[model samples]
Target: MCRQIHPNLAKDSVGLGGRSKETINRKWDELAICLNTHESGATKNGQCWRRVSLCYILLFILLSSLIDNFYNCAESYFSL
Candidate 1:
C-alpha cells in the first residue's frame, strides 16, 4: 500500500492509533456515519453495504493485478 500496513493480519483488523490519517479521513468517516449509522457500520466508503463491498472487491482485484505486474517486472530485472 501507499503506507505500510500490519504485515500479519487475521480475520479482523483494528487501526492502531488515537487519530485518523488526516483531516480527509475524519471528514470521510463523518459522512459515512451520518449516512448509515448501523446499516454500513459507518465504513469509510460512505456508501451502503452492497456498494461498499463492491468497491472493496473491485479494489482488491485491481491491486492484485498491480502486484502481479510488479513481480513480473522484478523477475525481468533479475534476469538481466
Candidate 2:
C-alpha cells in the first residue's frame, strides 16, 4: 500500500549515498504491492479482453478473405 511505502520512501529520500537505490527498490516494491493488491481480477479481465479482441480480428480477417474469394469467383464466372 501507498500508506505503508510512503513513509519509508520519504525517509530514504532524505538519506544521501544509497538514496537512488532505495528509491528504485521502493518503487519496485510499490509496484509489486499494487499489483498484488489490485490486479487479481483485473489481470483476468485484461487477458479476456485480449482473447476477445484476437477473436474479433480473426473473424474479420476470415470474413474479408471469404468476401474476396467470392468476388473473385463471381468475376471469373462472369468472364467465362
Candidate 3:
C-alpha cells in the first residue's frame, strides 16, 4: 500500500504534482494484483478436516436431541 502511494506523494512534494487520477487508479490495480499473488488460498482454522467434520456431526446430534425433547414436551401437553 505504501509503495503504491509514495510515488504520488513525491510527485506533489517536488512540484511534479501528485499522480494523475488515471495513474493512481493503475497503481491501485497493480497493488491489488501484487497483494493477491501471495495468497495461500486456505483461510480457515488450523483444525484437520476430519476433526472439523466430527465437530459438525456432534453439533447436529445435540441439535436433534433438543428438537426431540421439544416435540416430546409438546406431545405430552397435547395428550393432557
Query: What's the TM-score of each model vs. the native?
Result: 0.44, 0.46, 0.42
Off by over 4 Å in 1: 1-40, 43-47
Every candidate's lDDT: 0.53, 0.59, 0.55
Instruction: Give the C-alpha lDDT of model 2.
Output: 0.59
Task: Give the distance in Å from residue 51's predicted Cα in candidate 3 to where it truly belongs.
Answer: 0.9
RMSD of each: 11.0, 13.6, 16.7
lDDT for 24 in candidate 3 is: 44
- Give per-candidate clash totals: 0, 0, 0
Better of 1 and 3 by lDDT: 3
lDDT of 3 at 16: 31
Best by TM-score: 2
What would the per-residue lDDT of candidate 3 be over residues 1-80, giving only the tens digit for each residue? 52544455224232334646555445545544544466675333322332454578789999999999999999999999
- Candidate 2: where is the Cα deviation over 4 Å? 1-44
For residues 1-80, could you state the per-residue lDDT of candidate 1 as single tens digits?
22333322212223645543443344444555555555644444533443565578889999999999999999999999
Candidate 1 or 3, higher TM-score? 1
Model 3 alpha-carbon drift over 4 Å, by segment: 1-47
